[model samples]
Target chain A: MDLAEVKRIGALARLDLGEEETAAMSDQLTRILDYVAQLEALDTTGVEPTTHPVTLGEAFRDDAVRPSLPTEAALANAPATDGASFIVPRIL
Target chain B: MAADSDLARLTLHEARDRVTAGEVTSAELTEACVARIEEVEGSVHAFAHRTTDEALAQAAARDAARPDPLPPLWGLPIAVKDNICTQGLPTTCGSKLLANFRPVYDSFVARRLEEAGAVILGKANMDEFAMGSSCENSALGPTHNPHDLERVPGGSSGGSAAAVAADECLAALGSDTGGSIRQPACFCGVVGLKPTYGRVSRNGLVAFASSLDQIGPLTKDARDAALLLGVIAGHDPDDSTSACQPVPNYEAALEAEVAGLTIGIPKEYFGGGLDPAVEEAVRAAIATYESLGATTVEVSLPHTEQAVATYYLVATAEASSNLGRFDGIRYGVRQEGKDLLDVYKRTREEGFGAEVKRRIMLGTFALSAGYYDAYYGKAMAVRTLIRNDFDAAFGQCDLLLTPTAPTPPFRLGEKLDDPLTMYLSDIFTIAVSLAGLPAVSFPTGTTAAGLPLGAQLIGRHFDEARLLAMVHAFEATGQGRPLPAL
Candidate 1:
């Protein structure tokens, strides 16, 4: 991956990398990606790719009323809160 | 304490006795621990955040307070892996995104420790978002093995392992999704227990893989580990995923007799890629157990080799979704830019480390349409096979034994350049996680270089008490090795 691609991936990850970090990460990630790409070369046509190694099913609780975190406490550490609601900058 | 002084080496029970008898105040102990950190952390880099003043203040208050008559862990100094949150300390998970983010609430385990009068020392370093097998992926820097400064401590719980080995803390808490705690504990020659999933609450723990993630104890020995587990384990109403099961007296379980027990040795564990030294150490440990009247049965976890691949896919997918909240407007670091999109992009670009980004992309790609069934769905099916492998084996024996890792601690930067080599570190560890079983890594012997070698004992679901008894039996045989000289 190029530095620009690194910057793009970092952007997608919601990070702020400096020029030096971008350059370094680009090189490091390139090698890692190249290694992962080896998985693509395998004959996975007949073989299935594994996701979770444990034999488990979906983990969801029944929809029932339970005590929830109070609004003030829930949003206490939110970076931007306005009147008990998280205030996010508008899209576009 | 001198730099080489092993004064911080006292067991949790011994330290608590000293504090309660007025021989040493909690402040004195915390100071000694902090002093050890100052003496050795420069080379070890075990901690991500050190709360010296906070810990000392808490320790002093604990010293002055009336007795609560709680379990043995009261007033013990403890380090928590950065993935588990503390109210005032930075809960970074060794990732840049949450590097400066402080949780307003404590995890269930942290709160329980405080109620039990244990001092929270600080947050220990880990792999970024607990994604890597080694702490090398940490946004800050790598945590070196206390036994050999040139070698990695093993991770994403490496910091906790190193701290325990260096006498920085009596005990610590680390999360294991795929051997994050056990592998590092093995590498550092400390005791690490990955309790059965849902055994501990994940409320304040940064999630990597929800189904598999478990918060556990890393200590100097099995008895100390049991003490910490006694304080931390059990159900929390806040975490619905936590098991609604009774918390047994783990310490009492330690004294339980272990005669006529059956231990399984999976043939798969002794397969290719295992270092001969590790194999030798593991066999010696098993023989010690056999001497304790335990019989070993050769078993198989046939799908064990596929665990790493399946884990990466499932864990990465969950990590990608879990980390999606840090888009510059929520709980962590933000970087301002021209517009809302630019702001989001730049913040993430600067905040997340490379390893975090790589997992996110890999996970996102795997979960994306047209690939989900082939990658994720298939992996889940394979997971069932792996779990069945354990199910079939446990029917024949009470517990399974394996080397915690294929090799001992590797030199720093040895596998940092290759994700495959790094991923292989979890080869032995991930299988237990895949099977959703409880496993603990205890020091069994030393490598040729005198680094600690550990053997892992995997127990049936919710059978940690039995595992503890078995390990205690082995430890009794004098095979429970001590820390290596740094």
Candidate 2:
């Protein structure tokens, strides 16, 4: 809940937090964590975590080549797209 | 027998019947709804985008194709939640990030509704990324309650509920992840149904918590909800979790008798946090059920108190992972930066609202290396116990009845500043979502202030038909309320 802790978490989440926003978040996260800390009192011995409500095995598609969204449609919503590909800042 | 001004007030089933019988044309219904929207949208602020020309054109197409056997929802104008993608309309999800983004493909629910001959009206407003309890979290601005402009319409599907309550649209599609649909319906005094997990396909819904989110209808009555659910529910190969179970004739199911049914009144739901008036109204609703020959029994969901904390942990953890896809590289608005990492950070910071950012940070903290087991891992285990609570309770009752929310809708901005207080509003409705059960919120009565109070009916998984039937019977008792004065 400290400023440094907020900064670390923001970095991990890839969010750029303002100083004011970070201060507010630190206080709020602390309050929320304290509230949720009640769960620590419960005994969850040997209980399986439920990732999802229903159990389903891996989904397999037909493996047939089907028509996909045309390149233009795929890139239609991109903010900066060259005609053929999304234009992102240099990664290297 | 009613004037065009009253056409917008007709339930979805009524409109469908009139259109199918040729007594009224889709153009007339569409024009009536358009006029209603025009009259109220300024105050209600329910829509993020309106599709007048497209709706009229679609209505015209339906009129021209009066096939021998008409579709179930022929010519009915329905609203879609902004979070659900529409092929040509802007699907903002009530965030600055996707404010101007339009999907190239319709979501599975939208596609199904279109194929069922429903005329798409527009996208209704919701909380940003369906993250908050009140519609106040919408980046566009909050949607006000139709009953009183000063009060908030409960959200993240607030606009959908408010629009239905105001008669701006016959019914609307809303997504519920931890009570988004039901809470708003309670506040707005309408019928909201969250079907079982995988009851409706989620292929086009903007993911919040992938496991908990489901598309549902906020309607004027249970019959309309059943009609809309029938049109939208079925197996979709596109959604891996969409169940392959045979879709029941929900409209037909509404005719079933309520006698000899066992209804459970959960002791936990009526405890300390519940408002006295809401408790009275909901208990009266149970009395009405009892008068109709239904048996009532007390049941306990011991883990009910932990639902909010558990929901935040599980939902935010999923949200953190799901929202990671919104980085500046692929879609929506992006802020340019010197480097890719800067682009990601700046775009997210600029695009997401405070609540969204708070959740992302909380989720990140939960899923962080040292804290994962204590928060996210423990929450998942608690979620299992919560689900098991419902399973055991259902063994004794056909349906579980409770108040939809702790209190009636409060004034706008009342709880906006405090996120925890806002989260507490959905305490009654969140557990059903966590258990992946189907539940409906219907107006049972109104508070002294004239705002509506709703009662919830939670059913076994995939038991929406039974839930709708019970609601229909309750509606048949001459207790179903009408639209609020705007």
Candidate 3:
């Protein structure tokens, strides 16, 4: 992968990188991608992919209203919180 | 309590028996562990965050209660991997992103430990976001191998295993996505088990790979592993993927007899990166089992060569998704930017370490438009073949034995520059994670240099009982469990 591709991935992944990091990431990602390329030699035709190890039936929980965490307690760890809401950068 | 109290070194079960017999109080045991931690923690660096006061208070409470028929883990101090959430305690995942973050509630495993009456010593260090095979990736700081100070304790569960080996805690909880538990347990000369996927709840674990992560025990021996596993294994309503299979009395399954049992030797696992010392130690284990009346059969996991590549694809892809929640919104360290999008980019940029960022970028690239099918999809398909290989092997033998890591404990900074080389460290342990089978690693012997050697025993899905039994059988001969001279 090239620096441009790495930049694209960084942006896609919401990671703002410095010039040095971008260049380093590009080189490392290239090597990793090339290493994983060994899989192309395998004939996996008609094989169903296993997304997860176990395929369990849907789980159901009781449909009863339970007391949830208090708003102050839930927001305790937030970097920026205004009592009940978590504050973040403006979207608009 | 003396700074070097031997009570701190007692195995989890031994401590439990003493506590139940009233020979020693929980407070004294807790003090012994605390004294031991104070003496060794500066050098070992095993804990990410120490809960000394909380542990003392918890231990005193256990002493005060003094209930008839004490609980199984009552008063035993155990270290938990930092990735698992503890109520109002720092669960950093060894990353700066969550450095100041604390879960408002306890994880399922934490709750189980609490109810089982076990005292939690602290949150143990790990590879940042549980990404690297060495603890060097931890943003907090690296944990050194207790066996040899200059060598690395394997990751991402390095701190957990080191804590157990150093006797900072009697046992520890470690989460394994790809050899995180077993590899370190091997390097540190302890017992580590990765239960079958869905065997343990993932409710409180900080996700690295949702499909692959499973929490298990790192302890002094197979009996401690079984006791700890029994407490943590079973279904949780909070975790939808947790299996509904009945939890067995794993401790009861520990027997010295290996008669009528068949163990598989996966030929693909031998040679190549396998160190001669590790191979010889593993071969000796096989011979010991043979003498105990077990038969050994040759088996093959032909797709073993592709496991690391597939694991990187699968684990990183899942990590990218799971970590997207770390955007500069609700919790953790955040950096301000012009807008919401810029905020996310900057917060993550400043928060994640080099290894965590690398995996994120790779995962995003793989899942990006046009590349998903080639990278992620192909990996999943290859993963199926890997699982099929295990299925075929299990069809021949009840268990599979191999080296936990290709080599013994490596020097700390040995593979830091080469990510591919670091990834290969988990080669023996990765495919088992991919197949979602249960496996355990116990010390086999130490090399000529005194570095520990570990052999793995893998069992069928949900067959942790048989797997622990086999390890116990060998352990009964006083064969493994080499104590680190640390």
Candidate 3, residues A46-75: lDDT per residue as tens digits? Answer: 999998787677898899899988999888
**What would the TM-score be for candidate 3 when compared with the true structure?**
0.98
Q: Scoring each candidate complex against the real one, what DockQ results?
A: 0.30, 0.81, 0.86
| Residue-wise C-alpha lDDT for candidate 2, range B22-104, written one tens digit per residue | 89988888888999999989999998789999999999998899777888888889899999989988999999999879999
Alpha-carbon shift of residue B148 in model 2 (angstroms):
0.7
lDDT against the true structure, per candidate, is 0.80, 0.92, 0.92
> What is candidate 2's DockQ?
0.81
**Docking band of candidate 3:** high
- Where is model 2 more than 4 Å wrong at Cα? A56-58
Residue B181, model 2: lDDT of: 93
Candidate with maximal DockQ: 3
Clashes of each: 16, 0, 0
- Interface RMSD list for the candidates: 4.2, 1.0, 1.0
Per residue, candidate 3 scores C-alpha lDDT tens digits across B1-486 of 434379998999988888888888888888898998998889889999999999999999998886666778998899999999999788999999999988999999999999899998999999998888879899888999988999999999999999999989999999999999999999999999999999999998988899999999999999999999999999998899899999999999887368988999999999687899999999999999999899999999999999999999999999999999999688889899898898899999999999999998889888999999999999999999999999899899989999999999999999998998999999999999999999999999898888889999999889898888888888888875777676
Candidate 3 off by > 4 Å: B1-4
Could you tell me the lDDT of residue A6 within candidate 2? 99
Among all windows of 10 consecutive residues in model 3 chain B, the one with the lowest summed lDDT is B1-10
